[model samples]
Target: MRLAALPRRPSEPTITLINVVFLMLIFFLVAGQVAAPVDRDIQLIDAAALATRAPDDALAVRSDGTTLWRGEVTTPEAFAAARIADGAEVLRLVPARDLPAQDLLRIANALRMAGAAEVRLVTDRSAP
Candidate 1:
């Protein structure tokens, strides 16, 4: 009588690997929906006394007097218009410390023209 061939073993189940891949896919998919806030190219001017309250909208003014909108350089008119059109009632001006007073004034003017309900300047509080 011929010897019977040995039976081949079945491969291990791949449920664990499949589960891991499925989970990773889900993670990226969910994460993709949330975008990181854009940072304007304008350098931030940190103050010794910045307000604890957060501003509704941020406008960055670079040292060179360049303006940034959402981390990109933009004209004051354009930025202001966008916020006002979007119904942004409150606007915050975050200018670099080195930013000239004149530049700051320009921004304020633009905000007013855009019809902001309230415009607040973001400055660090002086040391007590």
Candidate 2:
């Protein structure tokens, strides 16, 4: 008996790389960096009974005895020069919660000598 000829099937298709490239692009877009406000490590003591708005010229002192001028580390002299250049008439001091009393005094004195017309202390309000 003669065997019938069988029909040939189609060859295997090549892999498509377009989907993989698209997925990689989407992954990178979702994992991209997001811009956030820059906050220094300085902690402020909230001794005041209520919260008050601070002026543009604010000096923050960290618990580790480090001084920050607008979220930037700076010495008293440098801070003074910057303040003068920025035309700051008054300086608001925000001391960290665990800041040493002596350090606060030194900062206050330094701010006073830096040509600040007045110095105001800032504190956060306690939760009810």
Candidate 3:
């Protein structure tokens, strides 16, 4: 009589996938730039955070709803106009810790009027 066939080991397809994922993660960590606050002079608001970090080209606003571009005070309309003229589709705004909610919304609306597809708010990531 012939002997019964031996049992085979289970395949580990997930292991290869896991390895590739880890390699990609490590590659991104090494290649990506670390983020710093948009401006040292403009104290950013602190709140629940998001995954995406704003780029260095963000527009900063002070507590009084005064917008600053390239370290110069500017009206929201002016800032939006210049940025839109430069072919920017997405606008990143860093509002001060004491900036009023109404001001923020107004500035965002102005940016939208200037053809910004998206206006992302950037906040400070402070430990509680």
Candidate 4:
């Protein structure tokens, strides 16, 4: 074994660095797609009593258990029929602030029995 000694091959750390850089690039691309970017310098508006837009298509239940659709007197069965006829499976209900819980449940059950697939209640964002 009198042959000349072979020089040691240099460790390839550059390949590992390149791999890490590519991985980070892919991760950032996915992360950036997940959320929209907001301007850091802009201050968002703050309001204590912002008025919420009431849903126009939602059924309104009064404190006395009366049902109204767009200000016209309506019943749960009629409302459900009208909504279903219009190809709407989901129903939105806006109950009065003083409406009883039992009345709400009874109305919801009636709507479900009349063929509503889902019923959702709309309320204000403010805490009482």
**Collision pairs in model 3:** none
Residues 1-128, model 4: lDDT tens digits: 69998999987999999999999999999998998779899978777556554476889998999999887999989999999999999999999999999999999999999999999999876659
lDDT (0-100) at residue 106 of candidate 2?
89
Question: Where does model 1 exceed 4 Å of error?
Answer: 1-56, 126-128
Error of 4 at 27 (Å): 26
List where candidate 2 sits over 4 angstroms from the true fold.
Answer: 1-56
Candidate lDDT values, in order: 0.78, 0.75, 0.82, 0.90
In candidate 1, what are the lDDT values of residues 25-112, reduced to their tens digit?
A: 9999989888785687767778745654334367777778887777688887787888888888887787877888887887888878
Superposed Cα deviation of residue 125, candidate 3 (Å) = 1.5
Over 32-128, each residue of candidate 2 has an lDDT whose tens digit, in order, gives: 7454535778666775655544344777788998987766787765776688788877777878889989989888888788787877788766624
In model 2, the Cα lDDT at residue 99 comes to: 94
Poorly placed runs, candidate 3 (over 4 Å): 1-56
- Candidate 4: give the clashing pairs: none
Tell me how candidate 1 scores on lDDT.
Answer: 0.78
Indicate the TM-score of model 3. 0.54
Error of 3 at 24 (Å): 22
After aligning candidate 3 to the native by TM-score, how far in Å is the CA of 23 from where it should be?
A: 22
lDDT of 3 by residue, 1-128 (tens): 99999999797999989999999998888777565537768866664554544355788988988788888888777877788888888888999888889988989998898778899888866724
Q: Whose TM-score is greatest here?
A: 4
Best by lDDT: 4
